[model samples]
Target chain A: MSERLTPHAPLTPAVLAILLSLAEDEKHGYAIMKDAVKPEFGGITLGPGTLYGTIDRLLRDRMIEETGTTDNERRRYYRLTSQGLKTVSAEIARLNAAVAQGRALGLIQPKGAR
Target chain B: MSERLTPHAPLTPAVLAILLSLAEDEKHGYAIMKDAVKPEFGGITLGPGTLYGTIDRLLRDRMIEETGTTDNERRRYYRLTSQGLKTVSAEIARLNAAVAQGRALGLIQPKGAR
Candidate 1:
């Protein structure tokens, strides 16, 4: 695993989005890209360079791994590891806590309460 | 304002935390640092270098601005501009949407149902 990420280190938004995309099932690069650009995810359009670069980094950090099963010979599928799951989970909790604080401070409205 | 941040650019976790911290009241650097290291905020310990560096960048970008009121001559207080408020609100919304997707996919449990 890459030493760049400590156990509790916060993730970049791009990295977090990619992990969220693969949280459910293994997916090819193209599929991950499609999921990332959804309007809810901020409509972030990752170019091939940004997408693959993040993939490589995540792989190096053992946050994600290439799966043996591939529907297409040319496409490689990737899935989150146990570590990745834990990381994303922690991140989500942190975000939730921050949002809660925002609401308490009146900086953000509660869901369906806007 | 610095040209570095686009209206829709995703923020770094540290930057986001700072914005969220100032969402309510204007605070000094030390106060911001204290809020940022809370357990719910991920306990991210920021040394003076990292804290001031991010503050400088945020000031340049107009995401935060120095307030004229100072409790101490040595400490400078900061508050979020309209731009900062909008940016952090958008980020929280994006994160909430991502969490919803994760829950729908069974990757994350619904709040209080975990």
Candidate 2:
């Protein structure tokens, strides 16, 4: 087992999506789920089980923290910690690299190719 | 629950890595592992168990199939099926979309940005 001081790469879809969502801004659970459905986020629809389960893991991992604001008693907002930002940035870099590789291999068509 | 056909998106790292590697060319197990170590493939290192297990699943899912090349009797080669190509292509597109979103949100630095 490799031991480095950050969340592992190849993050689960749920985790990656949630973190990316939070990276944009703090949001409640429902807002994260809504953002996930947009095409840019892979059109992912997170069921409650996956959404909350991943949230729990992120919290435990210290990648995310809940805001203490009391304005909304029913909704708890969450945001990315510094560690969360680092992890998501790393993950995106990995994806960007893979995309470049795909283009070089001709596996993916050039942009605007029909 | 998504009812759309094709393997679900947000592929596990192992599965995506193996498919992307094979997308380049047919290879035996060891070759796949070798490619996984490269930086562009997310630097994923699949354990033997995970490697074989995911291979089994991919075969069962018809995304990949044994190439039946007996030139090297000890090694079994594998390649992407049409389905596999479609799957990997879609996955890359999803990643591309996410990267674009990351940029728009300023979550990821613009290329060449310091």
Q: In model 1 chain B, which range of ten residues has the least summed lDDT?
A: B1-10
lDDT of 1 by residue, A26-47 (tens): 8998988898888544457888
Give every collision pair in model 2.
none
- What DockQ does candidate 1 score? 0.50
**B8: Cα error in model 1, Å:** 5.7
TM-score of each: 0.88, 0.92
In TM-score terms, which candidate is top? 2
- Judged by DockQ cut-offs, is candidate 1 incorrect, acceptable, medium or high? medium
Report DockQ per prediction, comma-separated: 0.50, 0.73
- Weakest ten-residue segment in model 2 chain B by summed lDDT: B2-11
Once fitted onto the true fold, the runs of candidate 1 whose alpha carbons sit more than 4 angstroms away are A1-8, A40-42, B1-8, B40-42, B107-109
